[model samples]
Target chain A: MTFFYISAAVALISSVLAISRSNAVHALLYAIVSLLSVALIFFMLGAPFAAALEVVIYAGAIMVLFVFVIMMISSGPGSTQQERRWMNFRLWIGPSVLSAVLIIELFAVISPPREPMSAKPVIESKQVGIALMGPYMLGVELSSLLLTAGLVGAYHLGKRKDDAAQTEDVTIHD
Target chain B: MTSVPAEYGLILAALLFAIGLAGVLARRNIIFILLSIEIMLNAAGLAFISAGSKWGQADGQVMFIFILVMAAAEVSVGLAIVLQLFHRIRTVNSDEANTMRG
Candidate 1:
């Protein structure tokens, strides 16, 4: 439990710094620490499977590509562009309020149970594999197809550049 | 010693998720934005695992694996596009990339 609290504190601090920091690389490094801390929390909670996935996928794979993209393009913030492009608009206000409500609802749901920790050992990936690939295979397949399409579209969009002035390397879809 | 319960982790998860949202909202750097989204995803994953363990279910673990796979796909393809966008635009700032305005 102490470990969980420590991990939580670390994750919180890093995440806050991840946004507040001006250096883009430093921000990414902070994000990585936050991710690892969350992964540690998963481990302490007895979900070793989620813990492993957290470390491998979020900390390892996704972050590697992020660093790679940063290197290919540039490091740190580009010119002090102060274009106040609706950074404080109503577009996000409504969603944020709704999210806050959802968080409160989650708190209500989780606060009641004070049962002792279960004695069952940690669940492994094999159990998860059976659940996802056996009973829940269809949804997973559709998501995979969706990912493939996204990759192809991104490739197509990114392939037509032969110039040096082109700066952005990834264009997210709407 | 009084230890924090798993429910406290939910609150922590909510806070972390919000921070990620702020990162995605406030930052203009593309790499930072991607990192923010990663934070958001991991936060949700943490909530899932913690809740699942508290409730005694393996479904959460299973969901996390898929989430991991999706994260891998996202970062790979996302970075590839970022690389290409950088190649064509020479800038990674979202505010600057206005090549496709409709």
Candidate 2:
């Protein structure tokens, strides 16, 4: 429980920091920390597989992708200065108040007393694998299709016009 | 061993989601907007995991995996679009991309 609270706090704080940073790289670093701490919370909640995926996919792969893009874009000091200028206190106030109202409503809705239940056994990755391959197989297949489409779309969108023209000669049959 | 109350986990998720919302609303940069959206997606995943844990079921984790898959696809395509947008405008500012408004 202690670990859960600690990590939860860490996640929240880092997430806040991640969003508020002027530098994109700095924000990505904080977001990684926030993700890692969320993984810890998942482990504490007895979803070990989810925790592992959170760390590996969320923190490692996804964040590395963001970092690579940031590096590729090479947003310089001028961009950071622009970000700082854009992130003025007046811009923050309205959203912060709105979110605060949202949080209050959420808390009110979920804070009602409920029956306490006994703790369940940990869910192993093996069961998750079986579940995925069994009942959720269709979802898995669909997601794969979605991923493939995303890959193709990203390739098309990111391709340079000249590069596409150059490759057109190679795809003359198509 | 004692487990944290399910409500606490849920509250944490709510807080994170709200923070992400604020970021999305407040930030003008397209990259930050995407990052904020990631945070919001993550908060939803956390809520699912917490609810699944409460019920002692594997379904929550399954949903999380699906969410993960979607987020991956979204990020890849989103970043690609961002890259193309940057190439065109040379600016990451969302406000400057007003050419599509009219």
Candidate 3:
């Protein structure tokens, strides 16, 4: 229970930090921490398979892609300093106020039940697979198709138009 | 083992979702915007898992797997578009993408 509270705090603080950063890479690092903490929360909730997937997919694979893009687009040190200079204190007021309101709303609404914890069966990965394959098979197939389409679309959109050939032989400047 | 209340997990998930919303509404960089969307997706996944726990079922985890696949597809397509935008305009700021503006 204490571990759950600790991870939840970590997730909240890190997510706050992530959204507030001006540097994309810095924000991404904090987002990874936030995801890992959420994975811990999943573990505490007795969903170990979900926890592992959260860590592997969110914190690991997706974040690496983000880092790759950030590096690909970064201008240089001059841009780093420019990003820091662009971080005006006034810009944070909106998000901070919104977050505060949400925090207050959550605390006001959630009243824990007095009943003590009861023994629950551990959910194994095998059970998750069985359930997925049984009742949710359509969802699984659709997801695979969606992933394939996304891959093809990404490839098509990302290809450079100029790579093939120039339409005109030379530019005609009047 | 001292088990925590389900409300605690729900509260945390709600807070995370709110933070993600704030990020989406406030952040100007497209990458940050996409990242905020990912945060929100994860928050939803958390809620589902917590709800499943409350009911003592694996349905929540199953839903999370679907969410995971959808998120992956979204990121791939989104980053591809981001890459294309960068190549076209040389900027990643969302506000600068006004070519379609009338």
Give me the candidate number with maximum lDDT.
2
lDDT tens readout by residue for model 2, B15-84: 9999999999999999999999999999999999989888888888999999999999999999999988
User: lDDT tens digits, residues A132-159, model 3?
Assistant: 9999999999999999998998898778
Docking verdict class for candidate 3: acceptable
Q: Candidate 3, A12: how far from true, in Å?
A: 0.2
RMSD of each: 10.6, 9.4, 7.7
| 10 residues in a row with least lDDT, candidate 1 chain A | A79-88
Clashing pairs in 3: none
Residue by residue across A1-174, what tens digits does model 1's lDDT show? 544556677788878977887766666666777777776667666677776677787777677777666565654465234223323364344334433443343354236673322343566677777888888889689778868876886677567654422332333322
Residue-level lDDT tens digits of model 1 in B1-102: 243466887889899899989989998988778888888888888787877777767787777766776776676677777776676566789897875735
What's the distance in Å from true for residue A135, model 3?
Answer: 0.8
| Model 3: residues with Cα > 4 Å off, grouped in runs | A75-118, A163-174
Poorly placed runs, candidate 1 (over 4 Å)? A75-121, A160-174, B1-4, B99-102
Q: Give the TM-score of candidate 1.
A: 0.74
- The TM-score between candidate 2 and the true structure equals 0.80
